[model samples]
Target: MLGPAERAWCVVVPHQPRGARMARHRLSTELVGTIRPGLLADVVAVLAELVGNSVRHAAPLPGEVIRVAWRHRLDGDHDIVQVRVTDGGGGAVPRLRPTDLDSLDGRGLHIVAALATRWGSDRDGLGQSVWAEFRAPAARLPGPDGDDPAPNDLLATR
Candidate 1:
């Protein structure tokens, strides 16, 4: 497993359907080897949903683009990943509302909520941002004596 490491990245893409694709690819590329495969996949999926929502429902920022950002850090042996997608403000805020069972649409926020440990939205002067945080594998594991792993373990599972 990888050692304790931290990184962040941001990219601005045109506010179009293709923007989500680009953001997903960038997220996967930046985080590929730094995290476990399953964790990376979940992060990428969350990024996709956030970007897709911005492109489909919100307007472009001042530059007619959407900003996708992510941060990866070790929080006391817990690996955490948070992704944010920013777009021009919309009349409605992003939130989890019950969807029709037979409906073919409006489940993006639901999927994000299911996979992310926490999620919410914030508004700025020019735009709004929707973000989610996920927890990666921790360093703690049963020791020879069935005790918690040492602090020096560093959660190195890479």
Candidate 2:
């Protein structure tokens, strides 16, 4: 469950080629001292892929900006991280493609799907948002009754 300590971080950048790099750097810096190393890598990779896709496909309108937001929280006993990238809508919706091994491109969503426990996108009047969620190893902590909760019990709380 998310507590008062769980706060999301967000940034908006110009919808340009360099925006993806900017978003990635911001995400890396925000996560540097907070998350575990292995999980951090996966989260960063997903951020890059999603941001790159937005830059490549969903080009923003003349004065529009891309929005990136991320948050880390404890859902029951699990540590969950969620990220969202939104851009102006003008391109085809993103989907997983069946690319051959020799293809030089079209693998970003596949990587995202593999790394993220769950991922999807939403579209509104402004644009579309691609979001992904990653779960890290749960930290064992004593429950209200002064005993650690079982894994199944923890899941049930969620």
TM-score of each: 0.83, 0.80
Best by TM-score: 1
Weakest 10 consecutive residues of candidate 1 by summed lDDT: 149-158
What C-alpha RMSD separates each model from the true structure? 5.3, 5.5
In model 2, which runs have C-alpha deviations exceeding 4 angstroms? 61-64, 139-158
lDDT per prediction?
0.81, 0.79
Best by lDDT: 1
Q: Give me the displacement of residue 129 in model 2, in angstroms.
A: 0.6
TM-score of 2: 0.80
Per-residue lDDT tens digits for candidate 2, residues 78-154, read: 66889999888646777899999999999999999999999999997767899999987754545668797653354
